[model samples]
Target: MKLQGKTAIITGAAKGIGAATARLFAFEGARLLLLDKDEANGAAVAASIAERGGKAVFRRCDVGCEADVRAALDTVVDVYGDLDIVVNNAGWQLNKSLLETTAEEFNAVLNTNLTSMFLFTKGAAELFIARKKGGAIVNVCSTFAVVGSPGYAAYHASKGGVASFTRAAAISLMPHNIRVNAVGPGTTDTPGLHDGARDTGDEDQGMKSFLALQPLGRFGKPEEIASVIAFLAGDEAGFVTGALWMADGGYTIV
Candidate 1:
């Protein structure tokens, strides 16, 4: 019950790590708003939470859209009177190298991975300040933010931006008692990972290639990453801010 009685907003919450985080937060006794472009699954996650006696409301939103983000913030306030934590977990990935990546594709990746995070962090800080209440913001970065690979140039850039931005935002919001932090998850066994494998032009082979590089000899779990996010968003991490907490199963160490 670390987050008991708190209200939260989790982006990209229709599936993968986002969906898992939402569920964990609910179990910790937090009311939340789940945002995702997938209307059906997003609503279903919320419904499932409700069935479990947890307060979760789903909103269909493109995190990259300013209007949609604004509407989402408004919806959270309307549905739950207060906002205590915000997890900017929405993201998209591209497997192309810099030479093969298109300008449009890069922009799209940044909009989803970096720009959306900026919006939610800014909006959430504003709400916290206006209410004179300090809050927590946990951003979802990636191990690729610190490491390099042959492909996924755009994704790497976006995640790197997320990490740096998290630090900069943390400093700016410190005086306001707002804590900003990020989680760098390793390769996880989520639909997104399989999609990335498909982008490699061979799903099975791509997965096998990925597994060959795992320091842990297996893929990470969405729920495991969600636990790291929950720690950052909870009061237990009060003294933590401006940090890139790694849950990468030793990915960066090697």
Candidate 2:
């Protein structure tokens, strides 16, 4: 149990990569605080963890809302006494070319993908500083953060912000023993991906297009990404900070 007795808060943990990470962290002996806007799904994931003999609690949180995020973090710290790890994994995708993207749409993507990271980092850093115990923060980025995609201008920009923010935050927090890092995953098979495909009205084509870009000829699994995140949050990665760890299955190689 690499994370035995640690307390972790994972955002967007109702399903997909966030959910997978929550399960893995629980198994590794972390008391889990899972947050998602979907109450039913979040509660279901928490219930499953408890059934497996792991400790967990679920809360409905819209990470984009500052008040909601603040209250949620306060609740976690109050319940667990200390916060050891925070994973900023809540995000959404909008497939729109730059020309077709509206201001509202662009803001929406930024708020969820980038702004939420800022809010959580701010809130968590305060807690860590107050406790005088350094903690780890893992921001979920995308391969697109480094590579440009035609129809993902907003998403790319937002994730790029995450990558940059991760580096800056890491440097600033190093003196406090806080480590800030990010994981850039390639296209993974998650509920969010499926939903994006459906929104494009070409689920099959969308999936095929994603597969074609991957050197592995297949999309990644949520657990694969979760594994990298778990490593980053563990003591094994103590010396690593201000880094963007890529798990793109060679998608960025080309």
**After superposing candidate 1, which stretches have Cα over 4 Å from the reference?**
none
Tell me each candidate's TM-score. Answer: 0.99, 0.98
lDDT per residue as tens, model 1, 100-141:
999999999999999999999999899999989899999999
lDDT of each: 0.95, 0.93
Q: Provide the global lDDT of candidate 1 against the true structure.
A: 0.95
lDDT of 2 by residue, 1-254 (tens): 99998899999999999999999999999999999999999999999999999999999999999999999898997889889899999999898899999999999999999999999998999999999989999999999899987897899999999999999999989998999999999989999999877777899987776677789888899999999999999988999999999998988887
Candidate of highest lDDT: 1
Error of 1 at 154 (Å): 0.9
Evaluated at residue 48, the lDDT of candidate 2 is 99
